[model samples]
Target: MRLPRPGEPRRQFVKRFLLLAAYSRVLTADWNGTLLAEIKPPKRPTFGMMRLRLSDFPALQNDFGSVRIGTSALTANNPLGLLYPILINRATQGQFYALLSECTHAGCAVRPYSKESGACVCPCHGSRYAIDGRRTAGPAFFPLLQYPIQFDGINTLSIELPDLPHEIEGSLVRTLPGAEFRLQLRFLAFAHLEYEVVFRASKTDDWRNVQFSLTPEAPLNRSFVSGADDYLNLYVEPAAGLGFFAVTIRILPV
Candidate 1:
């Protein structure tokens, strides 16, 4: 190998360094396609997580859409995770206020009435709730919970409902006493974290591990290797999980 001659300028070195980083994607990428760039994640638990997209409910608009969700098809078992039985208030159509698609009698999903009926009919017992949430027929003694629409003045709207409420995420694990998880990572760029890792608890249903990156970018923990913020071996035995454990990488802001 020939020894190259060099008398490089400091400014030139900086420029070259910057250029290399700008082009680092092509040169330093893991060709096996196992890695992604460092990502920014949400800082809080109440961040918006939509299991069902709004495109699923096109009728909702402005602030009204913000509160109601279409979870008729979503399989998430958590009640807060499900947003079905959406309430249609006066703002949505005339003065009608009710969960338009839920049966007022047997708690079966309410079937939308044909245009001729203009009344919501229960599929189970044929009981009826009016265009509004009141009981209009047999069996259903109580009216469906009446919720109103309130505009919060922002692009987001307020939907008031009694039957379904929001779900709170499990708490984060701040104490890593012997039972902790170690992740090995190589960041392609400067990373800001949201909720980075979700480790399923092995012990039981309630056990879970969820955490947010405190720094703008996370601090890496590695053993047996000394490198940049780039490469680190993550060593962890998750607090929640049995032998057949699963993990979820949460990069998107909630």
Candidate 2:
């Protein structure tokens, strides 16, 4: 048998091996890192939104107080689930008008319009939207956005909404009641102190020395104070009927 030439170098042999791999569709590329990873889609189907106007509503011939205008999408996502309530107003003797379906604050669901208030009030967050979904009161800063609306030649109407306004117009908050009296308590943690709590019930300084024991229920006073005020480490006690007390505490700085 004839011997093959030894002139080919080891690098040339490696190059030939790579060429064979390429021809066989084998992968040999470096994998320092990847730019993108695989991703999965949401499980449920996302339906498009629809809208309608007053003229188009009559064509549907929906019963009064028995129709929901904004929840047809729910039928697609959740068959058995009921759509949210959309309060429609009576434009004429028998016709209906679509109103803002969601509340302005926190985007929580809104209840039926209160004829007395002339606004669609949210039972949750206490946001009130007008018949046009305008923000009337509560924490919402913006009005309810309407859906795309269309009308048929007849009274039938079609409405589509892309994404309902889920964002809140503003934060939810309430006014806090002002305290009748400002008391100060200054004393050691475990020391016994004479204290009497009273409620003036009015702005006057007249105090009622209420009698009570701290073992069962510690009481607060309408006037005077006794609590460590972050500085000055000190303590003070008062008489049993001490209607109100003012004690200064001394705290040694570390």
For every candidate in turn, the CA RMSD to the true structure comes to: 19.3, 33.4
lDDT at position 29, candidate 1: 36
Q: What would the TM-score be for candidate 1 when compared with the true structure?
A: 0.34
lDDT score for residue 173 of model 2: 16
Scored by Cα lDDT, where does model 2 land?
0.33
TM accuracy, model 2: 0.31
Tens-digit lDDT track for model 1 on 1-254? 01111232212211000000000011223111111111112223322211222222334332222122232222222112223335443234323343534455555655433334655566678777665567888788877665454433333333433322222122123225544333222221212211223233333443244443332234433112222323222323224323221222222211
lDDT of 2 by residue, 1-254 (tens): 01112233323211000000000000222111100101122122332333333333332243232123331222222212123434454433444455544555554556544445776667667788765567888998887665444446455444343322111011111122442221122222212111223323343354344332222123432232232212222111223332322221111110
What is the Cα-based lDDT of residue 21 in candidate 2? 5
- How far does residue 162 in candidate 2 sit from its true spot (Å)? 2.3
Overall lDDT per candidate, in order of appearance? 0.33, 0.33
Could you tell me which 10 consecutive residues in candidate 1 have the lowest summed lDDT? Answer: 15-24
